[model samples]
Target: MATINNTPAKPEPVLSAFIKAKCPRCRRGDIFASPTYSLSGQKMHETCSHCGLHYEREPGYWYVAMFVSYAFNVAEMVTVAVGTYILTGSNSPWLYVSLLLGIIFLLSPFNYRYSRVALLYWLTPGLNFEPWRSADKPENPQQH
Candidate 1:
């Protein structure tokens, strides 16, 4: 009979996990309460449920997400500008500007959460995913 180990596997392609707000250390654990766009779903677990990884390194850490949020906002605006121009074949500056503004307002909440997730996953130094680093826990006698 074959025996199965008990250690959890490591998360991969950290970027995608970041987008989904999964734990950078172990993608198995979710960071956010909700995956979809919501007006009141910004809560995050204080520590990783799977690996005990800390979510916030220090006070004011999330403030750094402002830059990431700005970047996402700019990317969205440019996308809207190009899409509007290409589809409508119109060069009116006001049309693109108005559309960009509207989209920004609507996506602000998403941007806020996603940007923070990005900062925590990609920008935070010293923090990394070590597949071999199991959560500090007692040994299970049921496992081989």
Candidate 2:
């Protein structure tokens, strides 16, 4: 019988985890408890319930998420503004501003969620579970 020792696995890259929406650890279980929003518009859970990974290391850790969120918002605004201008050739500032505000409000929650997850995925990549079966097994064990 071979004795197996458990060891923590290497962390995943931030961008990969963020894009895949996988847990920062195993990359198997989902990070969000429920992808759907509640009636009250609050997220169900901030952490990965399946793997017990904390989404926010600290309260202010998510402050950087604002940058990510802002980038998303700006990109959306640019796209909308360009599309509107091209379609209508409108020069009214109020029209563009109103349209931008409406789109931002509608997409705020999504921006918030993605920004948070991206930060977490990047900042704390190793904070995940490594199963013994996968971590302990030799890549090519020789049979005697």
Candidate 3:
């Protein structure tokens, strides 16, 4: 004769989950199947493991992510360029070019992984965090 606890589970913070690259809806399952900097390159799960949300909502959905990635690249380049200028105070064009190129190459993986995450998390209008999906046990994990 045991009684069950009826309280709902606590939901994860949006910012924390976003940084961790968790499913936008459940914030439990991982969005990317592989690590960001893996040798095999980043691999994203087709659907959320917890809530089974299809990652690509429709045909050409991921094309939108290209724009997001471009924005991330631009912001990163600007920040790095400004930081390098302030730190070195160098007027050499080659210094700027080499440093910028190197930095962009290193950060490409990060940009690729987060761009899709950003698309799903913020750009998609209909998708939002569903508290019920974040339960310790999802009602139907394969429903997507």
Candidate 4:
């Protein structure tokens, strides 16, 4: 006869999972249908593979992702500007703008997916780094 181990499993980090495009709830499901860039652009899964978390909250839920995308764009611009200034000691405004534009254009697809993932993680109230594995029923079961 064998005894079973009852120790709970370690939960995956939410930030790391988001960066890897995994579901915020279980941290194991793949958020995107395609691993990388796709011919038809980035395709996202409707629901989590491991858990039953729905991707879309409502019709215009993804509009919030636009703000997240804007934030990412601004950050990317600042980073590129600083990097270019450091690499080439020429403090030209044109150079900074050109490099920023190039970098943004190159990373457009990444920005789109990242923004969506960020919003998904943020919009879900009470989301934790640890997996939400409670046996208790929610206050409102109908509001998923």
Who is ahead in lDDT, 2 or 4? 4
Error of 1 at 21 (Å): 1.8
Model 3: per-residue Cα lDDT over 1-144, one tens digit each: 111495446777999999899999988889988988998888889988877888899999999999999999899889989998999999999998998899889998999988999999999999999877787665654676
Better structure of 3 and 4 per lDDT: 3
TM-score of each: 0.77, 0.65, 0.89, 0.76
Top model number, TM-score: 3
Tell me the lDDT of model 3 at 11: 76
The predictions' CA RMSDs to the true structure, in order, are: 4.9, 7.3, 4.4, 5.3
lDDT of 4 by residue, 16-133 (tens): 7778988776677788988556678888899877666788887988898888889999988888777777888887888877788888888889989988898878865665433443
Query: How far in Å is the alpha carbon of 21 misplaced in model 4?
Result: 1.2
TM-score of 2: 0.65
Model 3 off-target regions past 4 Å? 1-6, 139-144
Quote the positional error of residue 36 for candidate 1 in Å.
Answer: 3.2
lDDT of 1: 0.75
